[model samples]
Target chain A: MNAMTDRIAGVLVLPQPYVLFLGDTTVPGFAKTAFGLRDWAADKCVGELRLPGATVTTGLEALTAAEAHARGARALVIGVANLGGVIPANWRASLVEALEAGLDLIAGMHMRLADIPELAEAAHRLGRQLIDVRVPPPQIPVGTGRKRSGKRLLTVGTDCALGKKYTALALARAFERRGIDSDFRASGQTGIMIAGGGIAMDAVVSDFEAGAAELLSPDAAPGHWDIIEGQGALTHPAYAAVSLGLLHGSQPDVFVVCHEPGRTEMLGTAGYKLTSVEEIVELTLLLGRRTNPAIRCGGFAFNTSALGEAAATELMARESARLGLPVADPVRGGPAFDVLVDSCLA
Target chain B: MNAMTDRIAGVLVLPQPYVLFLGDTTVPGFAKTAFGLRDWAADKCVGELRLPGATVTTGLEALTAAEAHARGARALVIGVANLGGVIPANWRASLVEALEAGLDLIAGMHMRLADIPELAEAAHRLGRQLIDVRVPPPQIPVGTGRKRSGKRLLTVGTDCALGKKYTALALARAFERRGIDSDFRASGQTGIMIAGGGIAMDAVVSDFEAGAAELLSPDAAPGHWDIIEGQGALTHPAYAAVSLGLLHGSQPDVFVVCHEPGRTEMLGTAGYKLTSVEEIVELTLLLGRRTNPAIRCGGFAFNTSALGEAAATELMARESARLGLPVADPVRGGPAFDVLVDSCLA
Candidate 1:
């Protein structure tokens, strides 16, 4: 039987009232239900974890590590909904013991993992064995039987809350109205497909990288290409193990990115800082070049409401000329962005 | 010297780093030189206070009550910056004694106040007044030599982070481009104006009426009219107080409100019983109505990106019909939004 030793300092005994468990079959079945329901439950669960004056711990304590392995339970899923404010040091120890006892971690919400160094250390000790579970980006689920024949377009953005989803949805609606086939999928969500199981792999890998980076060099900037790439490589094994668990049923053709003008300047939030409109256009070109060199990039769309349309249009034109790609201003009263995208794909 | 009685609890301290003393000099030179660096340094000389952590206290011992007072402090120039978390309770008694012993309550970032029920009772026994400082809604700053002539437009969102600031900035830029002058201000910054010496009396009266309704009957469906009137009134006291400070410098013409969609649904971070979108919209419209009636209502601007142009247009139209005021959809592609507002305002 697993024993609680004094070495485990942050032994947070979750109030019995809040602890919940779903059997293996039952859990997967619930996830298979409506996507909105799944997302809603996931968001609710995360919210519960964020409540103040509550301590939560998840793992198989009664069974030995060997027994857990026999039952196909390689890791414990520690769900952290929020990581704001001060986290006690004792809690850190419990987290370490849980991971050492073969528990993996999954955090929901925008968490500052760097704030907790102990968790990172525990993750490093576990190496490639740990897994992070996050929501799958809003993409067309597999087996829906939707087929794409015309230019299958996909749009991405520089960061969350930068009007990426709205722009993508708008583009999709615009394309559908025009009878052009298109798909919407975020890069993190796509990474899940690449990681195997139906589970979204990008968020997990992102976490692993963040954890490892914090342990190794806490000061290193997060969401940076180098850190992200390293985390992806390190978590590849866990991802492969769960490959069957994560499956991407659909794919898109042309990928378009909603470019935020001042992304580069904002370090931890989006990844880079944005100095000028030219920088946003250039960043899009660079992303296309680095991610998929052969895929012809369909122009850039700016959040004109945030950045003036005139300024955005001027910058796009300058960047398009320099990069040899078509640019479109999706802002109302300006040229139709959808028309430009369709023409480019054609 | 004042002696510490055992009745003190936690203290809520408001530390002001700088204070600009405005004497009887209207001359720019005298205003600038009167409050030499020494006057500002006086804040640091104020000794720290110790208070209890449990229960509510009154007078100097009651931190929350004291803070409520400082929030409405007039005839004094104090600025708070870089405050650490609230002070612990242990220091409350000592701090209170110090304050009573001729230690002027100069502002600093780490002011401590106590919150013990016993201390509150003691203050009551002594007949020390406990007044709830009224806070106001957002308004533009005065003395920048800018005036609102044609219209004083303000954009607010149904929820925070709903792209209100971006949209407002966009509209401002658009108006500037079209040779139509406008002023831009954030609500939070405007709320701070009260400390800078503005008093909006009309807004305060409205908030009082609304606060009374809320206190009288607390129910789920308190009706839109009541809630909106309350919010307008509640926010008005603070808004008016700040505006009073600003009016001492300049004036503006019409006031515009960039309508935010929902309130309770988005404002409350924690999970609560779900409320329908219709209910939220109703409440928002009510708030708009009450606020518009009280102020020189200019026009309305909707956040069309989240709530599509169609829904936003419909909502604006309904508001116009109900209040007989003009509304604008600054968002490009919004149907009949701009035209309606322009025509109505003209």
Candidate 2:
């Protein structure tokens, strides 16, 4: 067990009843945090606060920061997952308004909210916390890679922010439905907020990346399952270190490769094509063998949100036949997902 | 080019002409920092300071911190590289005494020297700097992994604290001797002290690991070579993420596999066996191709300090023949090392 787990876990105690803040974002993809909170923790979300030009919504009731605070919202959660996790200059007014209205500011951006002058001054004067979940806890030990007793599964991807988190969440829910013991081990900001506890693997120092992952899912019961949420793709140019470290430290006995069809280029990278599912599976097994020799590919999960039901079903079946493994969109849970769960457990 | 390079290069201005402090370390391996500085930056070093039980020496003139300060040394460099980079409790008195004697303290340990209460108080009172080289610079951009123009040679090891840094230093010097435009890019503390300026790759945030490496060796003339000092090994359970990130980011055209023959277990890892040079070669090529498809293994370097001259020679020749590559000890610079350097440039 990680010695710092208890102390580190205590550091991220966010106030409940949040008003999801959507900045000047138009794309629905950028509002994943709001959508995720609404989907997984709807009861905790009082409403959503959107800027003047914002076009995307999490379908919750809209409210201003003052209105949300009046309605008992204790914090304003920045719900946009932008390209660089940067808070725009235009968002300062809304953030300051929240602090003035007796609410804390919560963010998962790369840049801390406390670093922004207006926000920092407002929060300090208001005596409200400026919580940045992406800040890793200190003194995370280096990974030992010693095998621990557990039945583990991980959701890996061909790129960033595709469907790895959703797949793991769905798998863990299915395991619970079957009366199987399991936990959804989150590794990112959204998933951490949803799970209410997880280490921000990317925020840790490079020397302790794997150690942070190992601490995320410690030893469990022999039959218990840790459906670990993955980070970057192993083929990703910028973030593969986090991916590889999580893989080796999690030591998953089985893995599900997540992909998004029709996506050509990697996120935030040019001239780099999306890696093939076959390549992902091969590489996962090859590299994962360093820590877990019995690692196996459970199946594939395709984010077919752009495709109709018939087209998505046809593509999944065709790929399943080619790979000789179960394949399904975990979001569209059905008999196929059931088969995937069985194969993963088998 | 990196915009922050110039600013970061100015952060580590160590007042040189220093005293190297060995803090109760007996094993020569644990005193790598002292030896590395003595071997690479002898002109900057004035004398050595040892605690009562310290049995190791860098073969420099022994002088107390006060004596060294009187003789024009400006700082006391913590020259021990123990297993965790920790400062022993018994050595705190010596460190405080150095500050009393008007010497700044420079350390590459995981913990900052300024974080120690006594040292911090003394340094504050004395107005002396406590420079911690392991602290990474802020806002390192994510690696793009676009192939930059310039040849690179990285030295990869089978375990930690072996010959990776030494081999890179030797290769860079050899390149300069051959009238080649080259630079030795430091990635660790001792190397940073020797080279005067370089990134501490292991200290950066996990998300920016590759980015740090990319910034460490930026674009240069087509004929210029960047001999990068490698970090942890790819097969290492605790630190493979750092190794893999450096490999992908540097995009080394040629890499030299370094090993310490006759070692049974990995450093600091009890059950983990040492990785073979063959395994490292295969893994480096397979993973390194993600960034540089033309990546090649140039040769092998063995730390033959534990063996007799005849035994070392016989083993080098046999291994060279078996692997179909040049093999030599860079420290024992001879005709074999010359051949190794020739093959690396080929």
Candidate 3:
């Protein structure tokens, strides 16, 4: 295999049939990976493994590491998405136990699982892999902005952690349901775990962010579509670089602005206000045009988990009317969502 | 010192009063580091060391490793900014000789100097340092976009390797001449070597790029000016992420668009075209406004080396008239350059 293919293969190689380890996480947001795998890649997950004092559950059958391994699970995937993506000192013993249970320890944390001495020693002795999905593949080429054949739809956002990945996932599913050739392209840790393969764009070196994005979605059949999960918003103070790089490299023919209504301030940044959908559409087009001049906004995807059904419906309607674009909560899966899907194909 | 301060200190620690090593490069463009040191940091650079087959001259006294060491040169700074920032296999023997002559080896290459086995062994045996300025300091916090108390001027470019760093350096010098409280902030490898203590923004992880830029030019006295060197252009396919991150983090109050007069295609990329000065100016203002709402374009700095003295002058005047902004070739300092400097202050 060529070097790029080899590196991609190496990065994507993970022991499968996972027992999701949801470490003492009470908040659903913190347990996003466990929940994501349960919802999206349910077939690959054998069961859920919760630590003592854990208050959150993915609703998967609870199983011990040894039990899961006996049931044909090959890996224990760390399913927590903490603030810093760290492996806390309190969780070392539990991780080590999994390694000793004959299951590879898979993590999407910023800190590698092998960096923990106890887990590392146990994994080494037990001949288990410590797969770090968050680590970027080596030697990503600089982006060339060379256009590739195929259709692409990128889910951009006003603030991060809204629903860009979910929108992409839902769109990909919808496209598949319609017998359209489509694939979900992940760009973050949780999404990487869900898709089983993707470059964690944020983890890459700044110089190679676009290149990594390009690698994530390569040339495909002319009728095929790659629905790419986006990173930070164009208005994000810290992460716009990753967002722009993804936008340029993905060269999406259609983009959907994902946003959370009623979010006055941007995530983690107090003084920075969230960008409006109109502003996001304008900026994404202005910047994305450098790579694909034919790029256009397909619609808007609202994360309405915080709103009631009536309120969310009203908001989507208002936004759609004001912006003259289809808007919907993909999870709601109504006629509105159907229109949004049609917009993507259009 | 705190961790941030400690890391910065570690990154900036380099043996000074050096011999600049221009490798077997005949092209002046490839010998930019040698010329930059000879022209800007002349006092710190004691002499030049040229390898066999090198035709480039920095107009400094030529010295061998032993002679340069005897003359109190503490390090041999790699003075070639060659493509890929790599040390050629043929250059290993000459590098090893420098280590043997009791000098620390300093390089601003993509590959670390210590990674070379022969140089590493010699440096270890001689108890000399192998300084790699291309490595970013660890633990850069995510950019908060919290407004700082200093003025900043960033020199943005239409393409890479086209006078952005030189323009920023010249502008910093000009600001100093006017008794303005100012410092030149480096964002790339060569700039880091020249300035001795600035973050290599492009080398930083994509998630921390803006944060690294923020650390490069932190909060200063209200009147202080931090003249930040720009990285890739916003229109650049491969590296716009680095450019946008620096633009947002530096929060420049005034920006100068640096460009070459007649370049059609972008650097390195075959099919990608150059961004117009007007487009650059517009985009710089549009994106730069995220961090600093009052951001404005200062003027333009052109790389007029490809043109004759008269042609360069005529083009500068005509372009200045058309764009209605101060335009000059900073290398060819004249009334136009003085006006350009005035625009920055204004």
Candidate 4:
């Protein structure tokens, strides 16, 4: 049995929830899964999870997610893209433990945890909720290959870990603050969990990847903005297919090109330089215009975390003037969005 | 019941076989399937085919592929990518008729005709044969991400109808004539039936699309060329995924870019001008080198069918000189093969 030793790092400003993880993340084989859970669930996580040989960090105790609520834990997350997405039999007992504790189960894997008969029965009996992150929403309409009403924007990044999701969220919030109707549409596991109703694009089959996106970004009311969380970069080799699918599927009316201020190399390629902002915008329009010739790149959403406040602000201003579009660090502050809205949105 | 009427249009130089077409291909709905049969089976077909409303064309009779064989027909072809790849139940009777005549059935759809129990049992009882064109061979190994021996080539086109398959076949035949040990790897329906042993690349699921290519072009014997037939153009919107998958999966050592002489836009896109032969080469190499940096575009393979013989030859020569590589219309005879071999085939 794996137990946790708690060490609280700082005084919690917001009430942090505990989450019981369901993988033996201490082992090298499952470490990546454990790390991913830690990174993605950093916000709510307060206690350790129930898994064999799990290493508990952040001074959180390990308990089943069901029982974690008693210790301030809110959701049980099974974080892993396992082979065939199956949960081994040995893990079933712990799931039952979580269920008995009435923990909400959040499964980010392709395998639907709710499909397990025993777990489903136990959850039902205990009145526990089970969220399958990868299951696509039903009633996704087929793409009409025609322009629709309102404006949609996708946060496309130069590389993974460049904060496309953060920008999308920031933009959605900004639109709301500005008295505009807006929605944040997630396309990945983290985004799905955050939005509470979106498909994990990576887990979807290729044929339906686009279909799922289409479902997520259904036609919005006039003057509303749909800020879609984009998936992989177009330059990524293993992921380019999914990226293109999402682009074609969403048919965004406006585009938000996200990028890191200092990074220069592509993530997966062998020392391949990152495409310039100008080139990426042109490439995106070239492909997007195949479906909607009127589709245009609205502006840049730069992640200026690596730069000082003054430097980031100055750089954003310079680029804004040069590109003649809205350029901003949406999470912090910038001016890239106004021109973008004026150019693409009526 | 469908019947055939024979018409002898001209003196037949080649021994052609009669086939009983299953569906009423002459009708509006099934006409596409019927048309495919006419296209792919042109060389081996005799007078006509058997179908409910099939009309005798060019004085040829209509009969079942099976019954036609009995009357000197060679094979039965299911010539359509039917909805859900299903052969209509009423058509089964015609399949039965073909089985009675001992005709070998060729299925080109995602659905395997042999998988239907009734058809399977009937074929078995009558000792007839069923050929599934889309099934990947068993025991295909996973890609190791390691470089393998043997120089390989793939014919990538500007668009679908630009004769990539035609160029691949021409180059392979040309290599054989040069006493080179090489093989033609098929990746589409027409190429599959022609080779008699290849998977329909487009019908495959996205995950295994690359795996199929890897399986087909396993480490070859020293000094032999693996000329792979490519599917779809990278510039095509709907078809780009399959095309990219083939590119990534095959990991070819050499690129043979194919294009038509006068084609201006992508087949299915809205006013999308074809990227130049030069840019395509650069893009192909950029993507190809993601997996294998040593990968290079050997030269261009132009389909100059629209031009006169003299014009075609002159254009080929000019491009060859301009691109400084072997440029050719292998089907119509050119020097492209020689330069391609010299540049790529060590």
Fnat of candidates, each listed: 0.00, 0.65, 0.81, 0.09
Write model 4 residue lDDT over B1-346, tens digit each, in one string: 0112111211001112425254644444544444434554455555455556544342346554544676666456665444576787777877777767767676667567878888899889977667666554444333333455776898887877777877777778778888999888878766755454455666554444555566667787878788899877665655665666677767788888898878887765545577688867876776677557788887778888789988988888888888888787766764556766566565
Q: Which consecutive 10 residues in model 1 chain B have the weakest lDDT in total?
A: B225-234
Clashes of each: 80, 0, 0, 28
Q: If scored against the real structure, what TM-score would every candidate get?
A: 0.26, 0.87, 0.93, 0.65
Candidate 2: tens digits of C-alpha lDDT, residues A1-346: 2211244542244677789999989999898888998998788889999888999998899998889988888888899978887998988998998999988887888789989989989888888888777877666878888898888999999999889999999999899999999998888889876765577888888888888888878889999999999999888888989999999889999999999989998988747889899999999998899888999999988899999999999999998999999999988878899999999989
lDDT of 3 by residue, B136-236 (tens): 77778888888888899999999998999999999999999999999998888778767766787888899888887788788899999999999999999
Candidate 4 lDDT by residue in tens digits, A164-261: 87778777767777788888888776665555446666555444445556666766788878889987666554556566667876788778888887
Q: Using TM-score, give the best candidate's number.
A: 3
Candidate 1 on B1-346: residue-level lDDT in tens? 0112111211111223222322222233332212222232333222112123322111122223234234432112222222252333443454343233322222222232224454355445553322111222232111221212233333333333344344444454455545563433322221212121112222222112222211211222211111011111101111211122121111212333444555333332222222332332332333222222223334555555557656876777887777566656555524455553454235
Per-residue alpha-carbon lDDT of candidate 3 for residues A219-299, written as tens digits (9 for 90 to 100): 999999999999999989999999999999999999999998888988877489888888999999999999999999999
lDDT of 1 at B11: 10
Give the better candidate number (3 or 4) by DockQ. 3
Candidate 2, pairs of clashing residues: none
Docking class of 3: high
Mark the regions of model 2 whose C-alpha exceeds 4 Å error after superposition. Answer: A1-6, A9-19, A23-30, A49-57, A61-76, A81-105, A116-129, B1-6, B9-19, B22-30, B49-57, B61-76, B81-104, B116-129
lDDT of 2 by residue, B65-136 (tens): 889999988889898878776887899999999999988888998778988999999989988888787876
Tell me which residue pairs clash in candidate 3. none
Model 4 achieves a DockQ score of: 0.13
Best of the two (2, 4) by DockQ:
2
